[model samples]
Target chain A: MGVASTALPRGQTVPLALRWRRLGRRLGFLCGLAVLLSPALFVFLWMLSLSLKPDVENTAFPPVFIPTSPTLDNFREVFATSPFALYGRNSFVVATAATLLSLLVGVPAGYGIAKAKAHGLAFVVLVSRMTPGLSYLIPWFMLFRALGLHNTLWALIITHLVIGLPITIWVMMGFFEDLHPELEEAALVDGGGIWAAFRDVALPLARPGMVVAAILAFIFSWNNFVFAVVLAGPDTRTLPVAVFNVLTFEQLAWGKLAAAALVVTLPVLLLTVLVQRQIVAGMTTGGMKG
Target chain B: MGMTLTSAARHPGRPARRAVASYRRRDKYIRFALPALLVVAAVIVFPWLYTLYMSVQEWQVGSDRVFVGLDNYANLLRDARFHAAVGRTLVYTVLAVTLPVVLGTVAAVFFHRDFPWRGFFRGIFVLPMMATPVAIALVWTMMFHPQLGVLNYLLSLVGLPPSLWVYAPDTVIPALVLVETWQWTPLVMLIVLGGLAAMPTEPLESAVVDGASPWRVLRDITLPLTLPFIMVAVVLRAIDALKAFDTIFAITQGGPGTASETINIYLYLQAFSFFRIGHASAVVVVFFLLIVALAVGLLLVRQRTKWA
Candidate 1:
């Protein structure tokens, strides 16, 4: 297809048979892409349809793809019956706090590691990231109770650091590694101290990286289920836990459940759509380069 | 280089003094790393040490703790459920990793070619992975419904009988893995697409000029060049798959019986559900070892395949 398009001169016309064949091939390619994309598109669309339709239509025999009369009752019902507002607040607070804290700690660490060639320290951070969350959860659960911090957002915030901090460090490490060392060195060669060099030279250049790291950290922290499920009190439930609760308590209420799920996912979904390129870049760099 | 030139030109001598000053500066910078390291140590290192400590003692909820060194580990050996969970976890991980890697590579190859609306389609493709796992799981659970599900409806439309998806023990793991594959295959595709984008086109163009078959070119050149990226995808998918908890928990909660229960589910039950902290800690230790071993092994393989 690429060859056909690029090989042809702008003023030249293709033979009739070749043009027909090209059209056929283009259609085939579109079909293939659609087939590959169907599952992903269908799943989300189906959920959306479920959330829109009435209860009867939701569980209809053939399953309704579109509601005869689309309604917002399911979403309204969700807010009425559950403390989704509180859950949203909890998720926002925890995710924001965790991201900020991870940045404050991790960015400097990443810069230091890159500048000082502290491969051993970087490896430790990587290993810590790779360690299963459950391993830490058990100990943290015990420690939290011991320290009388269980069921508090403080407990949740600290635990989420394990997720956010590693990512911030890894992403920042990659960013710092890519930076020209001479910029900081030049700053140092001047009257600037190490702190000034970092604060003035490296930090400004790393702002985009910080944004990427912060977004990723926030997303992961927001999406975290296990830590919140174990550590959160009723009043402190995050969105995932709140959604899970809807599932448990309202098993057969498919519309309400779907609505709840969509509500919980809406923020991250919006973020994903808005900054997918950054997310993909961050994920690959953080995963592969680490 | 410029800094060094200017500094040397300014000083004319005392290069040794400059090196010492730079070394001192770097030493000071290393202190900036200490806060993060200390935080990680407090959060990760301390917990791991405590887990190890707890693993040696029998500490059930609402009871005095007693030292039972190695007993929990011994029990794990003799325990059939633990064995089954381990087996299930491994099988699940293999399916989860292999399917996504294969499908993703194929998808990446397709997406690498020119097509209309390619970027838009790729964006749509990655949605499942970025969506909250619990939400995706809930949606999949609805789709996996044997009677009312769209899946069964679609299957019936194709003249096939409706089958039990996540409800039946015999078919549960694969069914659950299907959801996993659906969600994660896009991730692998994205990673491999990156590799494809970064790859040199010279070999492929030359191979085409040599009249090499497309299949032959792909097998001998493209696959080999992308093997390192695929290995990276494998390593990541394996780690995440082994520790997969959210989707499985939200979907089947380890299933109709114990069929879908992987090591993670078992560990959750042991700790939170059963409240046997010691046993769960032992499981945690074993699980951590398993992950580290696999990671080290995969990293070794990845290193060997680092041709690019």
Candidate 2:
């Protein structure tokens, strides 16, 4: 139908011009998106090629754009030679723990701040986030050393909380503002306390927003290298820091590094796809109304 | 303002009662705000203050702390490496901010209208932002590998010699910027897309009816409407870009002759690798000032634009 509408619009000159204009706009939009997306697509396809190629073929001069002898050797190596699974498990524990902790502190905090109309407190949190990580890194470095907490997972989780908590709280503040206070008030009127009102009414309704916040926070904590790098002993190193070790130790294993990179990203990719809607909704919600 | 709020809330006959009530409320706020404020101050403010104090000292690994006031800052001022990091950081920030904003705005506009495969396309485009930075850096490192990497492979296909990418001092910052822009452009796109999605359709419809070209309408209508959202994205991303450490650490560890060592990486090296805690603290203090200046400047610009 679209093609027919654009095809000369038989016996109607005016309609034809309008139809052509619309067609032009559609074509332009698609082309623009394709151009914008090329960099992402290019890198993705390249990684796929490297992941599938065998080790020798990976280094073939005029390097193999496609695997002629595709194998799982690199993935197998990533698993067998290193503690890839252990690192992945550690990442999961740290990320999940950090996200849950942030939500615990941040959700109530976000609610209290928003309900109380504490814009000053909100601004204070923003300023805390605005302070570069290094400012805290130095002092915390000293404090953790003095406490003998250096190179411990506890240090990693706590330091990451500082980074992830504020962002989660701030984002939740926006989510909380969009919610109707009437629901919580209704719960309170039924003799529910503040905590109960949040638990049964606000929390249930805020599931989508919470999911978005949790996923983003988890992804960030999972990917955080600085805290993990500084605080994690070799026994506790997370995947990101582990992958970084590849650069220093394995100068020749490009394929293995690529495979390791893919392994690290697989979980976040799945989560991003799953929560894509909530995230995009959360981001664009305010602007569309204003 | 406090007095006015209390007066407005009070019955005319109860003015004195309201004043005392409001004073109690103010007292309550001061009380409730104290603990949170203390946590923030200890976690944030004390570190910064310590950084300032340590910056002036000449302490190093196992060395006596010499009270060298202003020496670290002075040394930084004369240091060529410090100058290079500052220059590279500014360059990276500008490109990373601008390219993403412009491209993201365009994407937002194009995707604003309904179309076939719209949902699929939207999800696919945001995939890069979902992919962690280390993953993106690793993938790009492969693509940029001088030998046996896809980027070089493609270059060979085009009859061009392969480049060293991160290893080449001249190319390191640009290479880092490329990876960053790749990872973050989707973020800018998502924010702009939100802004575009939120924009009212009436003004745009009227502009079209009045025979404004799409470009003119975009400039006068859509651009102005989305300026706040765009500013928010730019400022927030500038903060992150200024503190960029992850990908650089993964790919180069700020090496290949200090080509990619940002201020954040420099601070890390000083405090941890080199154990120049005092000097590193000074660098952190300086870096904080730069970030504060950028944030304050942006906020002021935003306020002025709003008021105007």
lDDT of each: 0.87, 0.75
True-contact fraction in model 1 equals: 0.59
Backbone clashes in model 2, listed as residue pairs: A288-B198
Angstrom error at residue A134, model 1 = 1.7
Which candidate has the highest TM-score of all?
1
For B1-308, candidate 1 gives per-residue lDDT tens digits of: 34644763564435577677767777887988999988988998999899999999999999999999999999999999999999999999999999999999998888888766666677788888888899888888888889889899999989999989999998889999999999899889988888888889899787766767667888999999988888889988999899999999988888788999999999999999989999999999999899989988888876775643
* Candidate 2 local lDDT, A180-234, one digit each (tens): 7545545544555666767777777777778777877887788787777777887
For every candidate, the chain B TM-score is 0.90, 0.83
lDDT accuracy of residue B1 in candidate 2: 24
Candidate 2 residues B1-308, lDDT tens each? 23322443452435476456435544343443344455566666777787888899998978898889998998988878888888888988898888777877777776676778777777777888778788778777767778666776777778998788887998888888888887877777777777776778899777766766657878999899888888888887888789888888788878897888888877788899999988888888888889989988987998987921
